[model samples]
Target: MTDLTGTSFEFPGEYYEIMRKDFRNLDAETEFLASLLPDAGTVLDLGCGTGSNLRALRERGHRGTGVDQSAAFLEYARAAGDEGISYVEARAEEYRTDERYDLVYSLFMTLNYLDRGRLPAVLRSVRELLNPGGQVVLEFGHLLNFVDSFQPNSVGHHRRDGVLITRLARQFINAHAANWRNEETLLVRTADGTVAMYDNFFDQAVLTGPEVRELLAAAGLTITAEYGGFRKEPAPFHGRGPLVIVATATPADTASDTAQQEENQA
Candidate 1:
């Protein structure tokens, strides 16, 4: 998430490989998003690890840029030399672009990597990077994802691309915001029977639906849709799965209205 600032942990060399191998939702995610894009639209994937989503978009006659903090992930993506997909290595919160995109998305709860203090910057950045009427699709784990959904401790196995991985995940919820932090240990067995392991750690803020909408409004963005899962259904009052938000840059009139309301409050 934040490059382990004020923290100590070794980043796994094969982190991206384990993620690509274990998490099996990239295709489904791209298909869900493809149905929502405008014709020939461009996308910018914040925290686009390994550029898998962008690859899927390219096959559908669309192109985009992928930005991430990991050089290894970006290099792996660039090796494809796919003209349709470009990448940059930068932290999501500090990165900016002069060119705007028709669709800007951060999937797999990448935004959660930014702690509460820095989320506003990302919201503003999304606002600036989006064209008028363009939408930003953000998916992130919610407090309920841990509180009501995932178990406190669990293990799973994945076998793909000639690698066998066993993941043991432990989650802890902070008392106040109910923010969820995860420490995952991966045991990877290579085809040659080499065994390696590493610990992956990250935390997500427990910002609720109201906080998200308010932050978007403050950033001159309007929420067009919010959901609990990938199926595009409305999120329950509290529930499992991520809180997926689809928002657009507010038009001039809506911006004016929001300013007026702020002034009135003052």
Candidate 2:
């Protein structure tokens, strides 16, 4: 098992489209996220894989830059020829830019790939990159989802353009910590009857609702809303769906005053 700690799991760039095709409702998700911003808003996509969401958002009249650590994914995204979308290869925690954005979003449990030590830095970077009153949206697996509905093993098969791909997944949860491990094997068969196999594994941290709120607050962000899914349903403290968090930077003066109070108390 290849340990994928603090990195995006390795997946064949060419197979990304096929693997992710039915995994998400791209149109609905784009509409949901776009409704949060003004017309023609500038956006930043953190951990943007293959720039799919960025492309969809671009089509909705929004221009954005995508940041991902995978060169292969970035290369594939750039080849799409989207006029206003730009790709940057960088990890979420280390990515910085002089251009502030009206909205910054990281989706599909991207932040979970980071452990507790790195998550704060990533959140702070996100806060610094947002414009005044700008929003940050994140989608991640919550503790409840993992604890209550985790499936240990699953298999999926997808075929596209004369290629057949089969994915087998196994999950292991840490009983003592807010983390889990996933092992995956991919089998690909091409039109010429050549077969290839790949095996890898990754770890993810699962934070509870309160833990997530606390982390965001400590990063100088205030949670504006939470949803259970893309449909904008109220987020339950315990559930089986991913948590969609919408937050904005706390007022500078307010954050400063709070920090001062904490120091004085200490």
Task: Quantify all predictions' global Cα lDDT against the true fold.
Answer: 0.77, 0.85
Q: Give per-residue CA lDDT, model 1, range 156-211, as digits (tens).
A: 88776687788898877666655677788888888899999877777667656677
* RMSD (Å) of each candidate, 1 decimal: 3.1, 2.3
Best by lDDT: 2
Worst 10 residues of 1 by lDDT: 1-10
Deviation of model 2 at 52, angstroms: 0.5
What does candidate 2's lDDT look like per residue over 66-177, in tens digits? 9888887888889876589888988787787899999999998887877778888889889999988799999988887888877799998989989999999999877566
Model 1 scores a C-alpha lDDT of 0.77
Off by over 4 Å in 1: 1-22, 176-178
Q: What TM-score does candidate 1 reach?
A: 0.88
Over 4 Å off in model 2, which ranges? 1-4, 236-238
